[model samples]
Target: MTRRRVLETAAFGAAALAGSRPAGAAQAPNVVFIMADDLGYADVAAYGRPDLATPHIDRIAARGIRFTQAYANSAVCSATRTALITGRYQYRLPVGLEEPVTTRFAGGLPAEHPTLPGLLRQAGYRTALVGKWHLGSVQDYGPLQRGYDAFWGFRGGTIDYFSHRGTDGKPDLWDGDLRIEEVGYATHLLGERAVRTIAASVKAGRPFFLSLHFNAPHWPWETPDDEAESRRIAGSNLRHFDGGTQATYRRIVAEMDTQIGRVLDALEANGVAEDTIVVFTSDNGGERFSDTWPFTGRKTELLEGGLRIPAIVAWPRRLKAGAISAQPMITMDWLPTLLSAAGAAPDPAYPSDGIDLLPILTGQAPERPRTFFWRYRANDQAAMRDGDLKYLKIRGETFLFDVVADPLERANLKARRPDDYARLRAAWDTWNATMLPERPDSFSETYTGGQLADHFGAGGAPTPPRPALAGEAPR
Candidate 1:
């Protein structure tokens, strides 16, 4: 495929200072990484949303640091998860190139790839995942084989919040590859599981790393009591084509917040609160029924709304309360930050494309400017943000914006900053050259090449039957 055709397609935190545990805190801290699915940047109360309140998510920011410019490595699910798992740019791996991992895809995160959980486990920490595990569900590539000591969640992108079944019509909920049945809302169930795990780990006296990835406010957008909506989607596309309202979105986020609070309450009740590093962030930006204020674009686009996300790091022992940092953090940054906090290093062969944020978080260092790059297969979307300026291209049209000044991305500065635009565009080209090429194996054989090409839509937006989501946007 030519570079032109490639354009169309597609497309966490915290804690401080190297081993400087607060006087009364444990030397080896527990890490709780909570990631929300398809959540908008301004959706959380702390971020700028007046329409909703996410107090639990807010506490992390109010008590610790709220990152103003946090970002996901990829605008889509599986890809961001890839970067989070490996602490490297998602583009460095073939798995990251997949817009989102489709159920029909043959390959998954290779079992042997160095992962955040794997490294923590190697350093004598107990690791667990208690929510969506979209990496893959194949026997060898599942979380159990990927270094998580325990796994209890679905292995697909989105599932019916009530039925807990994926679009494939299979029981996606699993406990170490064994299908399991459970009642109640998935968000509630996963929260309870995480709390239990935290209590169990404390009782076992092992430092733990728990990834509480929520599929809330994703698709089939149901609040805890939306059983009728669940039934409504039972026979249709599990994406929930018939439902969702702003009010429903409010309740969905509220439910997620309440569940997250339950888990945080577990941390405090178990007496591990101060000795644990809790991080709350999104896997990517929000989608339909989301309010991405002060930013443009949604999940599928490489605009600020799709990439910038709400992030907070509450390491009570190592970080001061109510701190805010304008760090240009990325999803991959968590791997190094958490690893550094754990006093571990990634496997030498698989070095990180991210930097550790402990120094900046702990006030030991100053924040410096850096250029961040993004590319999605759809619309030929590519962007480069350096300091205040950004160079963007969508469907072959290139433009420049002083993003810091124009957060809405309304201005087209290509003419005035031609030199800067060319420079940054070239910078993206140079960086893109160092990454892995898109892999045919990364796509599902279930899809025809022409269909995939059409989805890439070189001519324009793909034709009808297009679900509300194409980069899936949790669409």
Candidate 2:
């Protein structure tokens, strides 16, 4: 029998076994999706990062389902987030890119697009966003305009954690429609706000959907005093600091992990630990001090290291504990999966590129049948994964790899597997032909070369000095 037939039969069997309760029957579980910015695949202790201890993040994997072969839709923040919120490939829209900025254009997530929050709200759930909202800056593209009932975060790509100010000198912090001055670190503040929102929802006895996007360990890294002290106790070298930049970065990540623990504790305190569904992931691969070892490349490139990210889902009441699934899920899949868990049906007007992950999560389905496709317009790179084989093209060089065997993408099998390459390439060609041309404004000329330094007021100077090696001791 075909895979589809098998899945359908299994679903039926599960439903019949459930009797009064359907196979997927349950109250809409409260969803708290926590996303880290620019985190690497191997950065968390759960993923085998020996240097960094991420106990709380590791706890999520141990208590729930951990995805081994999951990936972001794009290699950069804005593009991946767009796919996540809309449940469609970002390339389908005009704003998709490896790097996107608001000042370059007036583009925003189109008003017609049906957002995840909007769908959940329609299903009688309160939705809120409590972190970065880089989809757009125009009044209409703001979180309030997009589907969220409440928004309290920044609209820019990166901001100072302490000052809550962007490089452009604008107040990146907001509470609803007004700009608010927040004192503590960005990661901690976002976490505290999330807890408060959950507490308020519990008081009202209303189900909620929260997108907690934390801009931690991204750049301009800064750590809290307590976090820095903990690192010192661990025998980390931060003395004679020489600006102590790398020390600051490591401490920032550790503290971010601590804040995540806070969120988990709050859920337990509110007596909603079992009923709430929590998902932890990153917007893209890691960069700078962040590590994505075993994977190649970083945020701006179309490599395994750049695209692959850590994804863990925890739904104690429903999903089996400590389960690990190797299914190749993507960012777009979350929308449909969460909506399904919330008992929300897909909107016919806003058809999604994602499929419901209920079958896979519940063990009713063994694997996903459809191939995954990715196209980053700004860099003109494209990739497609069919079964275990992946066809990749970056900078006009084409290659293929068996991703299952070579998750790090160390070996290329394009010459030997010409038939597989040809088929995937043809499929990609057909898919590419149907896509709309990237909108004219999507391309930015800022990072072309020396132009960036000039824009940052380096006065036509050479690149800034690199920090000393992380553990280098003074002479």
Candidate 3:
């Protein structure tokens, strides 16, 4: 048998040895999935960002398996989230094609679709989402309609950390679909709400699935003390193109880590730390100030940095402390992986493209090789990671690199290894054929004027007329 076949066989054998459920999982485990917005692969200290101190996020790495090769489904927010909640490729659904469900576009996660929290709730678990919900608006595609028993967060992509205003500078905070006004930094509020939800779940004697999606270190670059900065940027370009310094960025990330510490402490205080599965990762790669070392490209690109993310899984009952796995996994994998850990399965009608990772994570099976494909409407980017080799096509240019040996993706092995390149390219074409095609009017956020020059360098081509977000001030 080939090396890949041997590894697959061994993985299957290990799963068989571990039986149907993860060892030590006597009952359904509470799940706390923490997702950071625009966090780089090296954003966390454990992932190799020496400048920042993230002890709380580091604590999870110290206690469980750290995935060295994890990727987000898309390089953007809403698309990756679509794959995350559905356990399938984002391209499968119309909403997933948003690139990101930005303002002006009314794209939203369909309520009829089977979601992670929805399935878990059906399997006797209480589900709550206590952070950014970019899936859709509350009037139509709200989280409550998508399987979450309770939802307490904003419904847009970017919101002011202090004022809690959306991209359009309107109040976007919510309490189970009802618009409400509250005070404090968005990160702290979301974190504290998660703690309360966990406590409530424990008191009620039911397993809980808490999706804590934090919109930190993303844009406007406002720390908790930057409420004044929020006021300065309100009603203007919420993107804050000319704002944020590295020091301010550091403070933002540090504050997120602090809130994460609080959530960890809550689990321990509730005496369910051992019975809970905590996962920490990012929605996608970072932007301007993110430290995506040893990798090229940033958010909105099909490069390694744009797709790679830090993924840590902690379960005291099933995972060993300080363990590291170089398993190639993705955002959608969480749905099947967490569901398997909870003794639940994906809906048969909507089969998951991801595999259950509980067996491999618990050391019951060897890591198996997997192929992953990615595409972005911006820059006409398309990429595929098959084994160690990666095929990339962007701006109508094609290149190949062995991402394993060259994580930076500097070498072009296309001519040297023409066969592998052709193979992967063909594979990507086949996979892409199965998924929905890109629409003619699909929205992709492109740079303009000086920003275009800043992103694409001098003499860059001008972009098409972009749709103005509702209530956004004209430049």
Candidate 4:
């Protein structure tokens, strides 16, 4: 047998041995990681958004834990995804910032980095990725090289949901290496693929690790139906609405939620619901929509609105039902948490920035010590959240806010808390010194005049408006 086959067989043997233990003994739970692209904290029903309903996503929180202060490492797709996969700050790698849709950056999650899937796969889980895979298009960075056994998705950040075409005007859908044109809404198709992958893994008698990354509510706002769009478009004045794009965004999110329910149903039908862990979160914060009200700024900005997002972890058998945690966790934490939960050790060579969150989730651990930092090179925005205090710098304008007291960041205390600001600045500087200079490909000079307008769209608007999904902004 080949080396890979040998490893696979050995992993199966180990799983079988573990399975022979007494019934109800703790076993590695099947992990279903569902990440929505550009979803906001207030966009779901449980988060307090009454305008839109997200019964499926809210159900995860109803059955599990809902985190109030979870954040994405960055405000954009590629950066946050890198942090999620490697359990390290994105700045530690080349091309850590968000990339344009057309350009293929050389920097991707290095093979040597211990990704969540890689660590889980080593511990006998069958891994598959459905939907977006923005890590990299280079052979070494593809899902297959990064420990996923199967990949069915696009490599770009956002694609035309209906046509499966990328922002660069090319067909971006792929099944493994071969490009495949899939008919139907992208969100629904992704869910279908996820269910199929989960069912197949169960049939093969192996625990599964499925990363269902849906690119809904991201851009090119198109939905499964027109009524959903009409409802959202009726009140919005964003230019994208000129072509009934708001309807598309609304329908896309509704469809995404529906499809999510389908995946949950599949898990229940397969008898894995009790033993499976379903994690629902977003790649970054919301954009263009008024959904992220009370929190300032949108995606691409280093503000609470762009960083703070919804995070739900549902493991009915292992966690207390209907619990909520205020622990300040970030996307990077998933790697260590998943590995620890699966009884797998993180690779020693690739030390992780994230700590095991199992303790926090299980009510064993009380808090995290480390501060969270984010730097988006393109926009020259940086933020550091330490304890209850947060310091942000945008284009050299510094501001400090006691996030605990001012969750909305409306109160700037930089003048009153000079010492605190200095300390946070020092901490940020220390962290920044450790990271390599932004990769050449990752750096972009400021756009001037009309060039900027043309790139972002006329009048600096996002190419497509944000989705009016469920959830409420921080009060």
Candidate 5:
């Protein structure tokens, strides 16, 4: 559709929606979107971790549906978050193309862009974000400027769990644009704030959309007991790749799960458990000390492990409990799904790249096939999934796998299934043509000496960084 026609349709829809009350505004389900950063597909006990206990996370699975084929929009946090908020492919916007946005990145989600929270707010829902707003800087682009009515979080990718400082040695904690200092572990602090938001929303008798994005099991590898480790890494980088152990990772995940339990408890305490819609998932794949067993490769790779995530949804009022679904879904699907449940819709001017999965999720429809595409400039990597078949290309090698049968991606069937392989490859090319082209100067996560060796093999050479594409300034 033409841009002008789309905008005109959007204007008409907005006017019509404004004049009418939401289908069930008085009893609209309160949405609690809880996301964990860099959590592996099997990190929680519910998914299949053997060494850790995630009773709270497991509880969520038991209370609702668990999706085995869920995926993040990107292999990185910021990119996936952009898709989540905008309900579109991350590549559609310059800001989403950052791979993972950094403080040096020059753009963010445009304030004028239609966002999940913004649309929900217009539908008579109170919106708040309690943790991790890495979309952009607080100075120019922030949660308040975008969609969130109340924001209490940091504007960085990862922060010191105890000190709440960014890797740049700057205090990154905030209370709605104002930087603030709070003495506590970042995970616990965010959880506490989220509970408070829930309480406030309940008291006000308004349906709320709380985005509880947590930076857990992501980096710095510090639990509340690791304050000394936090102090040790204070002046240095928060990536503390040299630190962290399986036990430490366990503790971090455990703490996050505990905090989630608290948030769930608050819902029950406020007598809204059955009416609230709670979604628990991850931003991307896991990092070091993460167990993504059965799926080879980790974050940044286009492998199944990097893209697949654990997704659980609980809304006792509308969804059946303890259901398991094999339906393939991506991060962008959430916006349209939640909006449908709330009696709202995406802006017609920017139609969602995702479909409303509410019908399928609520058992109103059967499982269906889906097509997805992905690309990462670092290794010249690209991937496409069409049903059970996946076509992957990294460096200069091509591979075809039935990911449904070989979750480990150990078997390549390109030679045997040439036709299917060629079809998927062609489909990827067609889809890529529709999205924004990759800018040569765009920044992607890179590794140094030892890190390069860890990622590649010993004596491996790193791909040199490139400047921006011709005539295109870095976003």
Candidate 6:
């Protein structure tokens, strides 16, 4: 599976990508993909956050292509991360099967499986992850062992912003594998590390791929100035439902935006800003005070709101600035897109479930007819989108909607378009049959009042009573 053969097998082929590059685009570009945990489609200013300010996150959109119909592979964290790195549907791997991999989940992303970082690193690129590694917490399944050359961040889903501790109340911050206590907000720390990495990579003369997964605007939300809140929740669990407010959420997002600007500035400072492929998006939709305007659902549910994400790719040398595309793109698509951009390709022996979006992103190609399928919680939820039609099944009821026209998903077109509904439904069934079967863990759940958390994984640890916040999306 030589690189040459991979390019030859690529649908874009080597010549197409070669033409897509700017003059002297022969050298592979550095990649900086920043993922915000649980940030929603409308959370950022570019996506219409009038009450909040996110200039830095919006800058990527201003400078490059903004994807209107972009989606994460899954509606949850670990699942989408798995798909992003593997270029495959998350359910194909056991780690992806978990809604959100935690300390309780023993299975991990096997090292043998090919990864976006692993492939790039093999192609002489430096790789580092400077934020949350929620894939798996155990030593056997850490990020470094999988693909990244270095990892500096927490290893679980949710963490205390000020104290940098997981729900287990232990120090979750780390540099590589060792626990290093840094006295600062976790988001700020992650941004600083990423900025430093960018400069170091520039000095080393190697193309770098940095995955800055910020665990901000999530639960137990605290901004850079909230040290007192950390001490207040010292005795109780780390996830305090009473902590976050719209004002606090604004500050938290602002802090994240400020750090992102710093990192982007670092790229310019290193003289690689134009050559770097900078991508920014959320791992999933927003929750608890998130502005998912014009769309309804939130993370943890298989709905348009939970799946829709705001995405921007900024590579000034290759992509046009301020371009907008409504073509549907998913998290897995990054694996192939970036790989092709770097003149690297997946191993010929193993292929990818995601399509190469480079041609479409660069305006070299038009939107192609494609269908995407999703299944979660033992088939309790299923969704598929083909062209302009979408078929969905959640909570024991089926639905059909034209997502292009009805982004809110308020209209169920099953009766109006039965043929399209049947077509998409059959499409989902056939697609689901190709992936790995859902693990029993997804189906097994314990109720907590009006909310239900930890839909999967071996979560034996006692969790705080999850009070359904009435209007918040399904937990």
- Deviation (Å) of 264 in candidate 1: 1.2
Candidate 1: segments with Cα more than 4 A from true spot: 1-26, 439-475
Query: Residue-wise lDDT of candidate 5 within 400-443, one digit each (tens)?
Result: 99999999998999999999989999999999999999886677
- Winner on lDDT (1 vs 2): 1
lDDT of prediction 2: 0.75
TM-score between candidate 2 and the true structure: 0.83
State which candidate, 3 or 6, has the greater lDDT.
Answer: 3
Ranking by TM-score: 5, 3, 1, 6, 4, 2
Candidate 6: 10-residue stretch with minimal lDDT: 458-467
Instruction: Give the least accurate 10-residue stretch of model 3, judged by summed lDDT.
Output: 457-466
lDDT accuracy of residue 419 in candidate 2: 93
Q: How much is 248 displaced in model 4, in angstroms?
A: 4.0
Error of 5 at 130 (Å): 0.8
What TM-score number comes out for model 3?
Answer: 0.91
Better of 3 and 4 by lDDT: 3
TM-score of each model, in listed order: 0.88, 0.83, 0.91, 0.86, 0.92, 0.88
Best model per TM-score: 5
- After superposition, the stretches of candidate 3 with alpha carbons farther than 4 Å from their true spots are 1-25, 452-454, 457-475
Candidate 1 per-residue C-alpha lDDT over 1-475 given as tens digits, one digit per residue, 9 for 90 to 100: 2243223210101122223334555558899999999899999999888989888888888778999989888778888999999988888777777778776655678766899998887666777899988876547578877877788889888788888888765667887677889998998899899989999988866688999999987988788778987887785547654577899999988999998899889989999899899999998888767777899877767888888898999999899899988888899999999999888777889998889899999989999887788877655578888988888887678889987789999999989878998898899899989988655334311122253332343326222112323333221
User: How many clashes (backbone atoms < 3 Å, residues ≥3 apart in a chain or on different chains) does model 2 have?
Assistant: 0
lDDT of 3 by residue, 187-305 (tens): 89988999899999888666789999999878978998889998888886588888898999999999999999999999999999998999999999878899988788788878998
lDDT of 5 at 145: 75
Q: What TM-score would candidate 4 get against the native? A: 0.86
lDDT (10s digit) by residue, model 6, range 225-297: 7789888887555656667789999998899999999998998888999999999999987776688777876
Off by over 4 Å in 4: 1-26, 98-102, 138-140, 226-247, 368-370, 443-475
Give the number of the best model, judged by lDDT.
Answer: 5
